[model samples]
Target chain A: MSCLDTIADYGLRSIGIGERVLPRGDGIGLCEQFTLIGSGLIWNVYFGALALLFGFVFATALALAKASPRAALRKPAEWFVFVFRGSPLFIQFFVTYEALVLLPQGGLHLGGLTIPTGWVTSAWSGALFVLFLNTSAYAAEIFYGALRAVPKGDLEAADAYGLTGWARFRRVVWPTMLRLAWPAYTNEAIFLFHATTLVFFSSFPAYQQRGDALYYAKYFADKTFDPFIPYPIAAFYFVLVTLTIIGIFGVINRRLNRHLPQAARPRLRIRPQLIR
Target chain B: MFLSCADPSALSGLNWLICYLTTDKQLMFYGSFLVVLLLLVVVAPVALAFGFGGALAARSGFWPLRMLGKTYTAMVRGIPDVIFFLFVPIALDQGLEYMRHKVLCPDWTAPIRQGNDFLVCPAAKLPPTDASPFYQESYGFVLAVIAFAIVFGAFAANVISGAMNAVPRAQLETAEAYGMTPGQVRRRVLIPQMWTYALPGLSNLWMILIKATPLLYMLGIEDIVYWARELGATKSKIYAYPHPDWRLWYFLGLLVFYLLLTRVSEVVLKRLSARLARGQATMAGEALRKVGA
Candidate 1:
């Protein structure tokens, strides 16, 4: 088949929409690289989108727990963030995959109902869980810094207005925490997308050769013995995805800080030195 | 290995656990942890030196040398490191062999890159195809270390260059005015002052290096991850430790080891940061002064 035909076949193959079998022949072309890796971007988006969504809420809670005076809340949150942030995501993937494997082979029995534990073995569940915890630790750190940075005057103003407890946090603390955290949160999102590259690379197997952008890129690299083409294609897609993440997160950050005078709103800067 | 528990049949509970943990393979597994630690200890300083040299070269007056340094620093940004991890070792091996092939097999005219195979004179093979298993493994480990150092050194160069730039111009100017030589100024003022700025990025890089250690397994090193997978895979009924696929627990153990290492590093780095900030010309230093005053 022509390269165009190959594209039509495998273009949407990553999400199981197109050809069942992968292309294996003389050599993979630019079209094949573009299509297959693009197909694999489906997985990258799945991981990045869900992880960011869940990690945001969880990370806020973690930030609160970390900032709280109560040792009960603070200690666990501190350790949780410490453990996740301290280690490599690759190990976390292996640990999670292994832990999931050790789960009772038959689904865990609860009140005569079998809760599916096997799903954890799939990249969707296993890798996502690791990403969730990893991003939460990172975002928690950002949020914690932002929480500290929420101007003392803002809180004093809240107190002056007779705001207390949940009312104080919701109206005053929460928005400010988000606003201060937004730029760093944007960095975290970019890294999170970059980190999605590690999912298939880790112990979490991409079932049936169905994997992410890096996975297919790696596959073609192995098959063709050519690193030049496949890896750059993967990198090109990732850079685009990373820029898109920055763009989208930047918009949300603009909206979050729209209440502030433009000068006061934090500028979203891309400084992701940390990939994991 | 507790030899007192001589009988596997007599062992139970805690004693059984101790015996199992101390098995020969487990000892090898423990040894791999040391391998990881050694790689880190060796690679960090080596990579830092490489980075320092690269950064200095980039800032050098010579045009082509500066471009070379700049390119080395910039290369890491867009590429996935795994590509380098895979390509570097093989290429290095082939490159070495090719050099040896030219020297050792001058009379032979057959092309080295015949078809897909990278053929070389048998005498030129790295670690020799007939070498001991230990030599082979060690060769692979060395290659992995070199690859890691190359990648991480570029990252360190970026951080170090930034740190160097962050050192205020006034410091250098004052040194220059004082009749200090350029080398003297750099050594006395620039390097020392740049570190406190570099510490944060360097510490982050250190943690990343720790995380990246597990990729040793990918490079075919018999690292803890490799051992974990090997020992954790289901053993037959005939084997001493018959268990279900316990690779997850082994991996979890590796994860905990990394986490603990990172936690310790975090504490150490924080203390170092505090120490570095004590009299520096930063807001942190000013805060320390306020507290003291």
Candidate 2:
């Protein structure tokens, strides 16, 4: 088949759309590999974007809780961040997957209504849940650090302006914390996306062989025994996504620092989380 | 391990638990934890050495070496490391085998790529076709270590090179003015001073390396994750010790293992950083000096 035909066939293949069966063996052309892998990237974007979005709010709460002086609030938050940050995401995926899988196969029944538990075991939700918690922990730690690092002068200024409690937090504390954390938060965001690749590699099985970009890349490589093409293709796509993430976050970072003089603004440096 | 462990079915309470824990597979599970420890022990220094070389190369006056070092850091930084973890071993294996194929089987007719399969000559197979199981296992492990080192080394190079730069250029100039050679300046001043800056990054890298050890399971090493799945799966009535799925517990144990490891590392690293900071010109050193005074 022509390259365009191949694209038409497998373009949405990773989502169980387009082709039912993947092209096999040496007969699989680069076009099919590229199209299917790119299709698989939809899941990566889905997991990463959703997790980062939700995790952002959760992390902010967690950071606040951790920063709180009350032992009741602080202890749990500290332990949560420590446990999640200390362990590898790889094992977290397995542990979470196993726990989810062991849940009642039938949906949970509350009175007449049923809440589905089965989907919680699948990669779409299950893996996403794990990623959500994982990113929240890492980001919470980053935010907590930033919250601590927020200048003493900034807080005094807020107090002097008669801002207190919620007003103080919303107007002064939160913004300063975010501004301080923005660079590292950007790094965490990139790390989360890169980490989305591990979902399929984890215990959560891809339903119907539909998986993320790395999964499809592994599929092509296994079939072809040629690591050269599929991996670089996956890497290329990831690099593209990473660059886009940098661009968007860079804009936010600039906005965060807009109040500061250009010379005083901290530049956005993409620190490798090699932590992944 | 206890004498009473022979009759597991007749046992109960902690007695049965003791018997179950001492099973052969459980022994292997315990062994795999050490495998992780071994990887950390070996890979830390190996990766640091690789980083040292890459950092020095980046600082080299030569343009080509500088480009190579810069590219190493940039390339590894951009892509998810899981790709390298997956890519390097097979690529290296294939590359190694192909070299052997060229050297040992010059007259071989078959193309190495046969449809979807890799067709290496039999003689070129790593550990040889008839090698012992021990050798084969170790060979796979060595490849995993190399892969980890190559990827982490690039990150380390970034840390180390940045640390090198963070050491004041004036210090090197003073060393030169004192008639010390470039090599002597690097040894006495630059390398020693860089540690305070490099420690935090290296400590973070150490934790990451600890976390990444579980990826060995993906590379087909029968690691803790492998053993957890195997032993924790439903073990119908046919076995000596029957049990329903207990993977949640097994994985929790693994998580605890990692938590403890990370905690210990954090404590040690904090001490190390303090030690490195003492008697230096930084804020930490100043505070330490005040305490001493």
Candidate 3:
């Protein structure tokens, strides 16, 4: 078949479009491999984007709570970050899935209403939750560092301007903290995107084998017994996604540092050395 | 295991739990934690050596060696490590077997890649078919360790190379003024001074290494994850320990184990970092001097 035809059939295969069944047996051509794996990128984007969206707010709150003087608020936040960051994300997925599986089957009933808990065992909700928590912990640590590093002069300026409490935080401290944290948070986002690949491999089964990019890539590699093609294709897709993340984060980073002199603005450089 | 543990059906309550936890498989499950530590102990120094070589090569005057080192360090940047975890072991195994095929079974007529199959002479098979299970497991394990070493080595190389660059240029110049050769300067000045900078990154790598131990299950090593799943599955009445799925508990135990490992390592690393920072011409060193005075 032509490459275009393969794309037409398998392009949305990961999301249960075009093809109901994946390509099997012989004639697992390059086009099919590319199309299906590209299709799988949809899930990776889904897991990453949703987790990141939710994780950001929670992480900000966590950072604030951790930085708070109140021990009651601070201790729980500290422990949350510690527990999440202390363990392997792989273990988190396994533990979360297993725990979710043990939850009362079917749905929780309140009066006439039934809130389904079964979906929590699925990769979509379960793995996303794990990813969200994991990213929050890492990002919180970064933000906490940034929170601490927010200049004393900035706080003094806020006080001098009679900007008290929440006004002071919103006007001065929060912006400075965000500016300081942006680079590290960008790194966290990239890592989180990379981490989406782990979802299918973990305890949560990829229903009907509709999985992320790495899953399809693994499928092709297993079938062909050739690691060269599919793996690189997956890596290519990841690199593209990672660069896109950097680009998007870079734009936001610029806005954060826009008030500062051009030379003083911290450029978003991808620090590849740190892998959590 | 206790002598009474043989009659698992008779046991109940705490005794039943004890018997279940003390099963022969559970013993192996506990032993697998050691395998993880062993991987860390073995891989850290090996990876450090690989990283050291890579840093040296990257710093080399020769173009080809420098290019090779740069590539090695840069390779891990784009890709998720799980890909390497999955790819490296199979690739290394095949590469080894293929080499054995070429050298040991030169007379073999058939192509190694016959359609989808990777055919090799029986003699070329790693831990050949007739080999003992222990040898086969060991072979699999060694391959897993190598995979870890290769990936982590690249990370270490990045850290080491950065640390090497962070060393004060003045120190190297002083060594040169003292009539030391480049090699002597590198050995005497560059390497020692680089450690304080390298310690933070290396310590972080050690924590990551701890977390990555669970991926050993994916390599089919029967590591902690594998044992948790195996032991925690719902057991029928026909089995000695009849129970619903206890995987949640098993995994919880694994989580606590990792948390403790990370916690202990953090303490140790913090102390090590402080120790390394002493007498260095840096903020930490200056702070230490102030405290001492």
Candidate whose lDDT is highest: 2
State how far residue B19 of model 2 sits from its true place (Å): 1.0
CA shift at B256, candidate 3, in angstroms?
0.4
DockQ, per model, reads 0.42, 0.79, 0.68
> lDDT per residue, candidate 2, A160-208, as tens digits?
9999999999999999999989999988988899899999898888888
DockQ, computed on Cα atoms, for candidate 1: 0.42
Better of 2 and 3 by lDDT: 2
> Candidate 2: where are CA atoms >4 Å away?
A111-113
Task: Note the residue pairs that clash in candidate 3.
Answer: none
Question: What overall lDDT goes with each candidate model?
Answer: 0.84, 0.91, 0.90
Better of 1 and 2 by lDDT: 2
Error of 2 at B114 (Å): 3.0
- Which candidate leads in DockQ? 2
lDDT accuracy of residue B100 in candidate 1: 89
The TM-score values for the models, in the order shown, are 0.90, 0.98, 0.98
Question: If chain B of candidate 1 is superposed on the true chain B, what is its TM-score?
Answer: 0.95
lDDT of 1: 0.84
Cα lDDT tens digits, model 1, A1-276, are 687888789987887777887877644567888899989989999998999999999999999999999999999999998888878887888887777777787889999999987787889988898899999999999999999899999999999999999999999999999888888788778778877888887777777778898889878877765556777788788777777877788888888988889687788765436545
Interface RMSD of each: 2.5, 1.2, 1.5
